[model samples]
Structure formats: C-alpha cells, structure tokens
Target: MRSRNSRLGTAAALAGLIAGTAMAGCSTTGMDASDTITIALAANPTGAFDPYRNREFGISEVAPFTHDSLLYKTPEGEFVSRLAATWKADNTSATFTLTPGITCADGSALTAKDVAAAINFASDAANASWAYGYYTPTAPLTAVGDDASRTVRVTVAQPYGYLLDTVGLLPILCAAGVKDPDSLANRSNGTGPYVVSAVSTGETIELKRRDDYAWGPDGTTVADAPATVVFRQIADETTAANLLLSGDVNIANVSGPNSDRVRAAGLDSADAYTAAAWLNFNQREGRATSDRRVREALVHALDFKEVIAVSTNTHGVAAEGLLVTEPAVCPTNAVAGVLPGQDLERAAKLLDEAGWVLGSDGKRVKDGVPLTLGLRYWTDRSELERPTAELLAARWKAIGVGIEPIGENVGGLVKTLYQTGNFDVYLLGWDLRLGSQFIPYLSGPLPPRGQNFMALDNPEYVKLSAEANATTPPQGCDLWGKAERAVVNDFDLVPISNRVTSLFYRGVTGQLTPVEPTSLRATQ
Candidate 1:
C-alpha cells in the first residue's frame, strides 16, 4: 500500500539518481520467507498513504503494516492509543502525550513535529486529503514542542464529541526530514512496526520489519515478527480466493458473493463490515433527475431485497442510512424501518403525482420532455460494477425510465461529474468509521466550501448531524436515529445495501470476523 509517489518518484534525473542509489541500499533478502504472509486487495491504491491517505483500498493494506495513528479502535469498537500514550480534551482544545522513544524506519526519533506536519499536510488544500474531516474540523491544529515532553495542541471552532476517534487515525511522520509533502504522502515514513521498502502498485507492496520498534498494543514489542509483508492487488475475488487456497497468498479479501466458494474450498473466512454500495445522483440540467421528486420516485423503484438477493446472494445486509450498518450512526432501531424495499405501485403513484406521464417511447415525460437519465457504473473490467448496473438499468427501464448504463472509471468520474454538474446518476461506495465519520455524507458535498451535490438543504438534518457529532455514543445513537428517520422520511439520499467484506486466510486463528460496528484495528 505504498503510494504511487514512492514508486514513481519525480521525473527529474536528480530524483532518478537518488532513487537508484537508495534502491541499492534497500534490500529484499527477507521478503521471501516461509513465515512471511501475503494478502490481496480488490483494487489498485490511489496513492496518498499518509493519514492524509484518503483511499480505502490503500488504507486496508497499508494501515496494518506502516501507519501508526494516535488512537486505534478495538474489536469492541473502543478507542485506544497507538502513537500517543494518552490524550486530554476540553471544550476547545485537545492535548496529546506522545509515546516516548518512538523512531521512524530510518532511525530518526519521532516527535510532535512529525504528527503536526502530517496533520498540516492533510489539511492543506493542495494535498486534497480525505482526512481533513477529523484533523481540520473547522479548527487549526498546532504542535507544541520536540523532546520527550512533546505535547501537541489542537484547537476546535466548537466542541464536538468523537473528535478523539477522528484524530486518532491520523498517521505520524518524521516531519523534521520531510521536505516533500508529496513524497511523504506517497511513501512509507512512519513510526510503525514495519516500513515499506518496495512497492509495485496493483501488483505487490513489500514491507520490512523494524528491529528497533518496541511499541505495540499488548504493552510489548511483537515477538513472532515476519521479516517482510507482501500485498498484491487481485481485483477478481475468485482468483484471489484460489490463490489463497493454493497457498500463493496467505490471505485475500473475498467479495461477499464469493465467500461461500472460499469456504467450500476449505479456507477460513473472516467477515468485515467496512463499506456499502450506494447510488449517487448528479444535480444537473438536461437530466430527468434534475427534480428531487423524480429522484425520490427512482429511489422508491429500487428493491433493496432483490438487490441483496441478486447482487450479493444474501451475503450482505440492506443499508438503512447513507452510512451502512454502523450502530453509532445508524443505530439498530434506526435501520429497522428505513430500508428501501420494492414498491412498484407506490413508485408509479409518485411519478404520476409528480406530473411525469408515460409517453409514446414508454419513458416518463414531463412538459413534452422524455425522462432520460445517464447512469455511469465503474468499468474496471471486473464484474463488480457492470453486472450491478445491468440489473439496475433493467429495473429502471421497466418503470418507463430511459436508463443508460455507461462504463467509466467511477472514482474520477464521481469528482468530475460532481463538479461539472453534467451527469444524472452514478454508483459509488463509501467507508465511514462508526459514529461521527458518517456525518459527512449526511451533510453532503464535503470539504466545507465545496458543493453539497444533492442540493439538499435541511436545517433539521444539519442540526441533527451536528448533535450526533457532539454527543457520546449511546446518547448519540438516539439523536442520530431521529435524524436518520427524518432524512429517510424526506427521501434525501438512497440507501442501497450494506457491503460485507470476506477475508480468507490459511493459518489465522480465533474469530477474526468483526463484531457489530466497523474499523480495521478490530481485525488486526
């Protein structure tokens, strides 16, 4: 999970010369070992591996090996310190006490400066990090000092709960030596147990264990340490499961639909509730989806039960909120009455009530304009998106709506379409940590000053989302449930299905399957 910047470096000859010489000093003799483990991710990483590292695919692979955050969530969804030994927070600011004697891979002692630098990098508009949701939450963070007494200070615009959980995952870097933010953003330069040495994006990421590393959750250094960790990108679940079965890889993230196949092949299965598949509607002109009523009608047409059956083989749960299955955000009671099941009769009634009529072409029309919509699905050449889009298009077409399933790279397409305001519908996935992380989608069009693409402006939702952030877990659950019910009643955003990630491993023991609520620290 090393960033592309780490492998690609700079195009200049100066960087080339430095990289060539640095490559000579870096060795991989321990990478190929009988005790070493290899895992496969579903997609290629989108660079940016620092806490500022926004990509989920990269975080899934790299977070376990190279990055150490201030706090990590336990299997029970409780927060514990990782880089910082402890932290104290008040109404305005949070003060952190760094774990003593921490050093980066190159042997430079880690300090408050590195942590501050990583936060600064993530907050930088130029870096475009997805991590700003926690670190720069309408506040400025300042690092206080160096030395063993290194305490960092973070000032908030307003008091909010779950701030610790949000900031806990920001990775610490050696800020003193890092002159290039891009290099640090893309490369492995942290105080974790392992340091990435060689990376071939979409192929393999190689990490070497740090002998001097002594920090761990069990109050001692790891004893049974592997010399190296190799992570490969295997987008195809069947292929990845086969590799794990054949002993090519030690573990692989199998798709929910393919979990039974892996179990049948005699490999162990560990289920992780990480993300969900949801549809994004573009608020733009020349699209039938320009009207909110029309969008609501379209959502009403989707049968989440059928989606779970046909798409996931009943391996996943239907989503009740924008953020799937996280109890703190979309509590057990909140999700119970919110799933969007099929109601074709109700859907037709809504469309007709909205003044859209069945036209000669069998498509819905309003004011002599046919209801034509553009639906872009991920064209990764993998079966993940295309098949789902085909199913969705078929359902929509039957409802007198012209739905076109276009193939495109969904990541960039989402950003591009959002900004251009030219498309109608798109499919995307979101991974929000339990509690406050789910607030962003409800607020919409994040990055603060940016667009809230859905054009959904509800004073009530905004207040409830903030309250959900300001309150503690169980209490927050109650407040968030009310907010979730309000949003569903308004038909703001469509909740598709809660995705279940299945991991197949050969030598792992115990219940690796995660408990209710989701976080990567749980699995490790």
Candidate 2:
C-alpha cells in the first residue's frame, strides 16, 4: 500500500492512458465556428421534467436552465441565490422574501404564488419527487401577501430552521402554466432565464433564452443569451468525445481519463469531483451479506485501487465515509477510507469467525449451504457496474465465497429483488446531492421504517445520521467529523470513491473560465 502522504501522487500516476479512438460522428461543418454551445448529456432524464417521483434523471441540469431555483450551486459547488434573495428563520418558522421583478419567459411576474405552487407540488403525495427526500421541512406551505406590500411571505407548517437551504433548489413555477393541481408532472412554466423550446424523447431537447429576463443572486442579465441551447442525448462516451475533439459541438460531458484525449486532440476540458461511484448493498436480502462479518470480508476482498483503475481516472477520491466529500456530514472520528485491498488472511478469519468453511468446490459452506450470492448489474451495460461486479465476484471466489452473476431485465428485476430483500447480494449507487442524510441509505431501509431495504438497523448509526442531518452550518465541520467517525467504525457499509463531472469544450468561445460553463459571469 502507498503511504498516506502519497495517496494523491499515486492517483495521478494511475491516470495515464494509451491513444484513444474518437466515436461521435457529428457534422463538423457549422459546428467548427458556430456560436451555439451544444452539450452532450451522458444520460437523458428518465421521463418528463419532474424531479419528485422519478428516482433518476431530469432535475439537476434541466431545472437550472428552464427554472430559477430558490438557491443555485455554481460549478464550483457554492450556493447562491436564484429566486429568493435572502431568507430568515426563528424558533418556530422560516420565511423567504422573493426578489422583485423576476419574470417567467412568457412575461408573467414571479410571485409568492409561484413559490407556493412549486413546494406544494413536491410535498404532494402524487408528485413523488425524489428531491423531496432532501427537504427536511414538513410544514405545509402558507402563502401570504402583505396587504399594504407587494412582497410575499412563505411559512412552514412547523419550525424548520434549515428549510431555506433544504428547499434551496426547488424551482419556482408560474401558477398560470400549471393548469391542474392534481397532475403530478408538468413542464416549461419556470421563471428562469431560459424557456424550453422543445423536448424530444430519445433524441434532443432545446431551450431558448428570455430576452426580458433579469434575476439571479449575482444580478445576472440574460438579455443577451444565445438564441438557443440544444442538448443532445448521446449515450456513447467515445462518440461524445469525438464530437468535441472534431469541433462538431461546443461542449461534451466526458469522463476524466478521456479529458486527456480531448486536450491531446487540441481541445480544452473542465472537471469537478462532483459525485462518487459506489456499490449499494440491498439489505432486504438475507444471505452472506445479512451478516456484518461477511460484508466486511467482502469489502476487504476487493482491491479498490484496481476498481478505480478500471472505473475511471482521478482514482476518484477513495471514500471511507458515507458523505462522499466535505460539507456533506461525517462523524467526528471518521477514518479517511475503508479497507483498500484483499487480505486473504483477514477474509478467511472473518469467514471462520462467522462459522463458514470451504467445501469441495472451494466455496464456503455455512449451515449446509454454499455461500453463493446472486449479483445483478444494469443491463443497459453503460455504467462501470459490469467490470466492477466481475472484479468483486472474482475476488470473493478466491476467498471461497461464490458470487452468481445474474443476468436479468435491467430496472424491474433489480428493484424487485432489492425492495423485497430476496436476493443474496445486489449492486447499485445512491446519489449524494442530499448531503446531510448520508446514512439514510442504511437507516431508511431498516425494518418497520421499511425504507432501509438493506435492513441494516443500528441505534448508534441512526442517532449519528439524525444528528448530522439536524446540524446547522456553523457547527457543520465539527458535526460532520463526528458523523464520519461513527460510520467508519461501524463498518456497516463500504464506500468506493467520489466521481468527477467532466465537461468537454471545443475550440475557444470568448474568454469564459473553464470552471464556469457557457456563461461568463452571472451578468454575462
């Protein structure tokens, strides 16, 4: 193992790659000198523009362009105001005052009604927004207008001090655009600087700037935005890179390792270690994984370095704790990372301790049954799951643990097996954008609560997770440290590594900072 001080050095050295082949066959004619900024989405939103009910896709990128969220995150990951200028909270209630003169693309003024409608939509049972999980505010939204004033007021049903930050990214919707209150999905009524021009399934989506728009915490003016932005859904990574390198598109969101190829091809790239690649354990299943000792053994059996090598470049930050990075909470005594390599001796010890012994086929037999598990990967076969799962299975097999590679219809079977806790083991990922609830992946699925599909129930971890979520920013650093330590000590779950979001840009487009995509300043 490399010394702790050399972790980053090792990561950088491991990022080298041989010459790559470009795959995107886009037209190079108009794209070479075009003013339009085209972005290639790695994966399109699952369906529609709703964030609540859908578990994956749609909200993050689309919302930012078509709707002005309450709070926005700069590419650097800092939060800034969008619709609500400033907010305050007391012991029992939190309130947000709207910024004046903000208008929808249709020229309708943004008001308290828009804010209320948006939140109500998410909080409503019918909407089923996955974004709702991050919102801690349970208060029924009460919209009020000061009789003698044009400013509006928003109060929670209960005291939720962190409501503003929790609902920070909720997009305010124009009431006029919402024709029915009962419908869970709708699109294009947002008060952002841009308006949706068209959305085509499995192809491309487009947005047009609102010439009269003027509002962003930074006082950004969209009066001069490009006529339109076309987001093409290009699933192939090599193809996307080829387009950027060949000057067929203005930007492409490629992987970290490929960033080198883009530059080698005479283009530029920008990247941020945004999220991490992780394996989620379906706890509902009762098998070798049902035991903590077995889980720890499996974690120790797989070499994370190899996983990172095959997965992507950047060695993606190796995460020992749940909250992939800082500002995301961790326990006070959290270890920097979990076990990194296969310790056959340790794996055997853990297996022996759990009363499992090797059988004739070289697989462990516990209670008259071979410790074999059925593992499933997404059939879309896109993500790094295929190789990661194969590597994991191979390591476990060497340690007398049998892992059965199950090929099934992608989404449905995987979800069914996990939710019902019927499979021996399953692999998946949980997005960490909901920073504070780092432990919910484990806690939410515990029995009775029923969300803890993993069925991992520990009083201490639950307490630590709750404390972390309830913590305020002033105590953020300290609280996170405490939470991280607790999670690492339990060894209840294994965290792989953090992921970086890569944006590929072709030739020059003015003097925009690579860190900032598309626009120069909020005002630009």
Candidate 3:
C-alpha cells in the first residue's frame, strides 16, 4: 500500500498542540513586556507549512496566522466572514465573494483567480493534497473564478453535505504561491494578518503581524494582535509548562499529571476534546479479527470505563462517536449502547463458538494455531499506553487470547497500518469535526487504493453514509447518525475515550475556542 498519513487528527498532535506541565508557587517573573506571544509546540513540524498539504495539528494551529481561510467558524458555531465577504452554498456547490482590498505579504492584491486556483489545486486527486478528503470530498470538483465580480464558485460531483463549511474554510494561496508551489515548502505566502518573517528549520518559526491587514472574523483587525508571534519547538511537556509558569512562554497545552497542577494553580485555560484513543481491527480475509465473533469477543473482554481512565491518565470521557472535536457538524450520540459491556463468560463463549478452543497452556487455539493477535499502539503516550495495553492484555489473556503489543511512532504506525497491513488490532486517536469526515476511513477502498486501512466493508454503513452525503447538514444529520451507529454496532471500530486538551495561558488573552493567533493579544 502506498502510504499517506490518515486524514484524521492524531492523538499525539492534539496533546502536543496545547500540552504543558505545572509547578506550584511559580510566578511569572521573567515576563517579556514586548508585544510578542511565544507559544510552545510539542514537537517540530515535519513537512511544509502549506495549508493544502500539511495537516499536522501543530501546523494547523499556527497556519492560520499566515494563511487566511475564506470563512471562519466562530466558537459559537457560527460562520463568519474572513477573506470572503459573503458566501452561499447548496448540497454540491458553493460561491464565495472575496473581501476586496486583501493583499498578500508581498504587496500584491489577493484576486478571485488566486482563491480559485488554490481550491482547484487542493481538490485535484492527482495532487494528493491532504485537504482533498478533509476539506473537500474525494469526488471530482471544479472551481471557477470571476475576477470582474470578485467571486469564486465550487461544484462537487456528489452531493456533499459540508460544501460551505469545508470549501469555504479552504486556505487560499496567493498567485505567487500557487504559481511556484515549491516556494511554500518551507516559507509561506497568503493573505492573512501575519507573515512568516523567519524560520529556524525545526527550532522556531517567527511571524510578524501585517499592519495593513484589516480582514478577520467579523471585521476584526490586527490592532490588538501581537506584533510578533513566535512558535518555539519544545518537545518536552514539562519543560513547556515550566516555561509558561516562568512567563517565558505565554501559551502551552497541559496534559497528563501536570494538568492537575495547572488547574490547582488557577492558571487561565481553555479546554477542547479530541479523540484520545480507539480500537480498530484489521478485517482482511485471513485475519482472525475479520470474524465478527472474534471482534465482539475481544471488545467484551474488558471494562471500557477502566480502560478510559487508565489510558487517559484519568482525564478522559467515554467517547460518544468519532466526531469528538468542538462544533461537530452532526453532534449525535451514536455510540451510547452500540458496544457490548464487559462479560468474561460471554467473551469466552463467543471465542469458543468461533472455533477457538482453550488449550493446556490457557491459550486459544483454532485448528492448532494459537490465537495471538498483534496489538499496535502509538508510543507517544507510552506512560499511559503501556499500562492500558497491560490491562487489556491481562483481560484478553483470561479469555485464552494472547496479545503481542507492538509500539511505534506516528510515522511507523501509519506505515504498518496503511502500508504493510501486518497488524491485527491498533489503538489510536482521531480528532475530527464533521460526521462526513469519517466516511472515507470507514467504508472506502482499502489501503494503497484508498484510506480504508482496516479493509472494512459494511454494507449498511456504506449505504447510510452515501445517503447522508447526498443531502446537506441538518437535513442529513439523521442519516449520518445512523451511519456512525452501524460502524459501532458492527465492531468495525470501538470508540475508546476522548481526552480534554487544555491550553494554559499566562500574560495573554484571546479566544480559547480555537486559540486563533489573530485573536490573541499580549496582556502584559
């Protein structure tokens, strides 16, 4: 399988984006008085800052400063104008009228043609843009720009539900960036409130506020925005927290045990939930997990409540569905009772009925082959994953099942799951904001051909998802809910837990709903 990072947001990225640690009694002593905000990134960004390509959570958090979307979704779930002054959309087509006077950092005007070109580049399947699946539907699409009227129109082949939300939010590239493309690999070019002033490779990315920029959500300007925004790469969470406490850094995310200290210290914080962990089985023909009975037996072997607690370091809630991020387009409870509760006897019975018998060594054997499943997990949260894996292994072992834990980094995990297809079960997190986003991962072609890494083929899920996609939101919500439920009920994937990532800030104030750099301003 040709590998591509899954479109869903990974847990490590979410945790790193806003993560920090805390030390009691520490005061903001060395606070900088300049009009600059220093934000700590959990790790250095891997790829380019191209909004159409890089979807890394860390990059997404900072990209807004350099690249402006046509429309912005407010914390209140309302769509507000940014680069686009007005917009309207139907199920498959949308039009956006650009806000006049917007200019790129290079002193060139941002025209309708530039915006349309960005949409076209990102929508083309041959370009392999990450935004292809997340922001736009995989189906063929076209964009036309009427420079005379300052309007850009997009039309999809299928009836996509999120035409406005997805297409409207696509980051527009300037004429220069689109023409060259290669120039945006390490640098940036767009019509936003800030410009990339300097890049120190993996160490730091510095952005300077644009003085003439007047376009922002609801007509907000950069009058109060910091003059310079610095994204400092700090791989260690505790170190990031210490920097926040000392006033060396203004913003950082707090997770794990350190989050409690930050809460106790009464530091200002904003919380957002993301997919922390989930279980997905490889259902290729010969895999043991391909059998529904085995999948159900494994799910029924352990208490999810305890698993959530242990896996999230006691800082998570039971997942309601795949859409855990804030402002989910369809916030329906699709996972309430879809999964079976912990029942050891039922698990054992199901395993036995699947033709797996317990042997002398207390291991399940089917046709003389031991039932040892390869359980893969990302090692970014080894502190929590190790214990969670042990807890799961202990429970499954009691049911005469053996588990071989395989730990890998994010890149390695993607390789094994999407490329090699060597694992049986894998645990990971997903940060998704729309119901339609799950369709590609749930029912599309498998691997190299598509992103359905688990090779799932659920007729009901496929049917419901297609119906849901044929209509617009609110109108399609019911179908989307039923579609997600089908995936859960069939054990295609299990929603393990969702963690609340808190962004702690000191000497700064802004919108926490998303922590937009344009919205942030120095308090000291």
In model 3, where is the ten-residue run with the lowest total lDDT?
1-10
lDDT of 1: 0.56
Query: Which regions of candidate 1 are displaced past 4 Å?
Result: 1-35, 53-60, 120-127, 134-148, 176-179, 218-220, 274-277, 284-287, 322-335, 338-341, 353-355, 367-369, 378-384, 407-422, 444-455, 508-524
Residue 427 lDDT (model 1): 63
Clashing pairs in 1: 50-53
Error of 2 at 80 (Å): 3.8
Could you estimate the TM-score for every candidate? 0.81, 0.78, 0.89
Taking all chains together, the TM-score of candidate 1 against the true structure is 0.81
The lDDT of each candidate is: 0.56, 0.53, 0.74
Query: Which lDDT tens digits does candidate 3 get at residues 1-524?
Result: 01111121123433222112221223334444446777776544555666765545223456677888899987667999999899999877889998889898778998888888888988776775656666777678899999999999999888886877777877777888777767776667888888777666546667788988898997788887788777776656677677776677777766678767877877887766656568888999899999999999999998988898987788878888777666778877878978889998999899999999998888999998999999888765334566777787888888998899877754566578667999898877766777766776787777665668899999999999888888877888899899889998999888888766667888888875566667787877
> Model 1, 295-315: lDDT tens per residue?
777777887777655455465
Scored by lDDT, model 3 comes in at: 0.74
Tens digits of per-residue lDDT for model 2 on 220-239? 67544555555665556677
| Candidates ranked by TM-score | 3, 1, 2
Better of 1 and 2 by TM-score: 1
